[model samples]
Target: MTPTLILAIAGGVLIAAGIYLLLERSLMRILAGVMLAGNGVNLLFLVASGPAGLAPIVGEDPELIADPLPQAMVLTAIVISLATAALLLAMSYRSFQLEGHDEVADDVEDAIVRRRAEADLSSEAYVDTSTDPNDDSDSESGGRFDGGRVR
Candidate 1:
C-alpha cells in the first residue's frame, strides 16, 4: 500500500486504541492512551504536511520543496507530549505511593456534594441548614464542617 494510506490507517488505529484506553479507570492505561493519542496526532501532522522532498533552499531546482513548519510543529508537539507523559508518570507514582493501587478513586466530599445537589433538585426543602439551629451533619461529620456547612 501507499505510504499515505498506511499512515492514515495507523493513525486511525492509534487514535481508536488511545480513546479506548482513556476511558479506562487505570492510571497506567490512561498514560498509555495519552501517548498513543500523541503519536496519532504526530502521524496526522506527517500526513498533512505532504510528501517529503528536498530542502527548501533558495536557488535550487524549483520542484518538490517540503514545508518545514509542520515538521517543526510536530517536533515541538513531541517534546510537549514527552513532558506531559513524564508528569503523568510522576503523578501516577505519587498516587500509587499514597494509595495501594493506581485506580482512580471517588472523592467522598464530591459524592456528598452530588447528593446534596440532587436533594436540592426537589422542590421540597429538606434540612435547610441555614435556618435549622439543630443540624447534626456537622456533629456527625467529625468537625469537618462549621455551622452545618462543609468547610
Candidate 2:
C-alpha cells in the first residue's frame, strides 16, 4: 500500500515537472521534459497494473497470472521514447552548433505571410476588362453553363 502510494505521488511529480519543462522555450529542456514524461507514464502504468504476481506462462493459474499487455506496452513506449529523445537531442545539438542557442526563434516566413495577407486584404478590387462585351455566352448563363451543357 505504501509503495503504491509513493509510486503514484512520484509519477505525478514527474509529470508535473515534465510539463513545466516542456513549456520552456529551450529545446534541450523540451527533450528532458519528454523523457521525464515518458518515465512518469511508465511508472503510472506499473502502478495501475495492480500487485505483481506470478509470471504469465502456459498452465499458469488465471487468478495468479499478471497482465502482460501493460508491461509490453510500457516496454514499447520506453523504446520509442528513447529513440525520440535521442533524435531531439541530436536536433538540439545541431541547432546549438548552427544558431548558438536552444531558444526557439520566430519564423520570418510567418511575418512575410502576414504582410502578404494584409496587402491582399487592403489591395484594390480586381477588374477584368479583357472579356469582349459582345460575348453573349457569359452574359446569358452567368458563367455557369456553356452552350447548353452544364460546364
Q: TM-score of each candidate?
A: 0.72, 0.70
Candidate 1 lDDT at 27 equals 90
Predicted structure with the largest TM-score when compared to the true one: 1
Tens digit of lDDT per residue, candidate 1, span 1-151?
Answer: 9989999899989999999999998899999999998899899899988898989899777677788899999999999999999998988898899997788888886676677687665433343346445755455345454322542
Which pairs clash (backbone N, Cα, C closer than 3 Å) in model 1? none
The alpha-carbon root-mean-square deviation between model 2 and the true structure, to one decimal in Å, is 9.0
lDDT of 2 at 95: 91
Report the C-alpha lDDT of model 2 over 35-122, residue by residue, as the tens digit.
Answer: 8988998999999999999999999899999999889999999999989998998989899999999788768866755665766643
C-alpha lDDT of residue 44 in model 1: 89
